[model samples]
Target: MPVLEIETIRGVQLMTMNRPKSLNSLNEELSSALIRAFHMASEDDEVRVVVLNGAGKGFCSGLDLTTVDSIGEQSSRFQALDEYGWVGRLALAISECDKPVIAAMNGIAAGAGLSLALAADMRYMAASARVTTGYIRRALSPDAGMSYFLPRLVGPNRAAKWLFTGQDIAAFEAEQAGLVDEVYADGEFMPHVLRIAYDIADQAPLALTYTKRLLHASFDTDLRSQLRQEFTSIKACFATEDVAEGMQAFSEKRKPIYRGR
Candidate 1:
């Protein structure tokens, strides 16, 4: 079976990590497939939003440590990995994706799996789901951008606490702790995620993509630099035919049909 399954719903590109027997753990094949999928989604004009999830009872269980040899055999080219060399590449792919990426985690997201979810623009969790650092238990430091994304998502103190403990955090607890955005019943999880994805996909494409870039930049850029970029972005959006359509729709009291011109 393919390591990754991809389907487009409306303008949202859905990527599912496929390895149910291991809770969709990240093998080399799955990692490479996900990296390529993110890059492809970014370049595909038909794709407006990206949604990531795993198939089966749980989400990724980190590095697939139960594989033939300590999570996976060391291929000659993969020897450079101390902690998921390819997973690092995977993280970069998601970071560079031009469209908004959402993680619709329907089950437990442990270790690097949590890191993957944390990297998304938004995260929605299943009520029965749980999350944890999943590193300290194995006497290892965090990997797959966990340290970076965790601190940014839930603040440094909370990030440190979770990393040090490696305890499983329930979905509602994660939401209360600001780790996850929202929690829904497992049966209803994907539907809720898709509903939001479609709503976002229905908006003007260029405006949405640029808005995502601006918001991501806001975390790193200075106020003056961010303001300037926002101004530049707004000007660019104004130049698009969608802008005129948006204004006309506003006046006409109807929804705008954006062709992404």
Candidate 2:
């Protein structure tokens, strides 16, 4: 069986991390599988959104420490590629995908795993979930885009504190820090997350894709450029059938029946 399992429900690509025995820790096979899955999702026009989650006790426990131990510490180029290549690819997969990505944090997420969760467009955590920057405690600089993501989301001071101390923050605290969008009780977590994913999948496909792309670009684009880009997108939206349906529905005083044109 594959280390990663993928299922599609209501146009949402559900990617599940399957190594429960390891708390779904990252390893070579899992990383490569995830990269492939993301690429597949990106190419499949039928997939409107993605929902990510882990099975069992945790989302992920970070890198497989034993795997790194087996490789032994080395400064060789091959070692660097072995450790960082897939991580970079995974980051790219998340950043470049037009479809919205939502992470459902069922339990603990640490180090590189935490960075992966942060890459998602939105994150929903179970009340029992916890997240931590685990690199500093293990004498490592942040990788897997943790350095890049942390400061942007939580500000430099909070990111610095987390990176420097490497402490875990519970789900409620993570929500307060803006690292998590919402915290649901374990009993309600999966259903709530699925509902959100279904909601995104129900939107106009082209509009949602363009909106996700524009939002990603807004981070790097200047205000003037973003406005110009948005102007183009807004005009394009008016040409779409879904937008036509929205207008007609409003005039009819009824809920819009968006066909995801």
Candidate 1 Cα errors over 4 Å, as ranges = 67-84
Question: What would the TM-score be for candidate 2 when compared with the true structure?
Answer: 0.92
Which 10 consecutive positions of candidate 2 have the poorest summed lDDT?
68-77
Q: Which prediction has the highest TM-score against the true structure?
A: 1
Pairs of residues at least 3 apart in sequence or in different chains that clash in candidate 2: none
- lDDT of candidate 2 over 181-244, digit per residue (tens): 9999999999999998888887788898889989989889899999999999989988989998
RMSD of each: 2.2, 2.6
The global Cα lDDT (0 to 1) of model 1 is 0.87
Residue by residue across 1-261, what tens digits does model 1's lDDT show?
A: 898999997899999888989988877788889999999998898999999999998877777875426444565654645454777878878877898999998887988788889878899999999988989998988878898889888899999999999998999999998888899998899999999999999999999889999988988989999999999999999999999999999999999999787
Work out how many backbone clashes candidate 1 has.
0
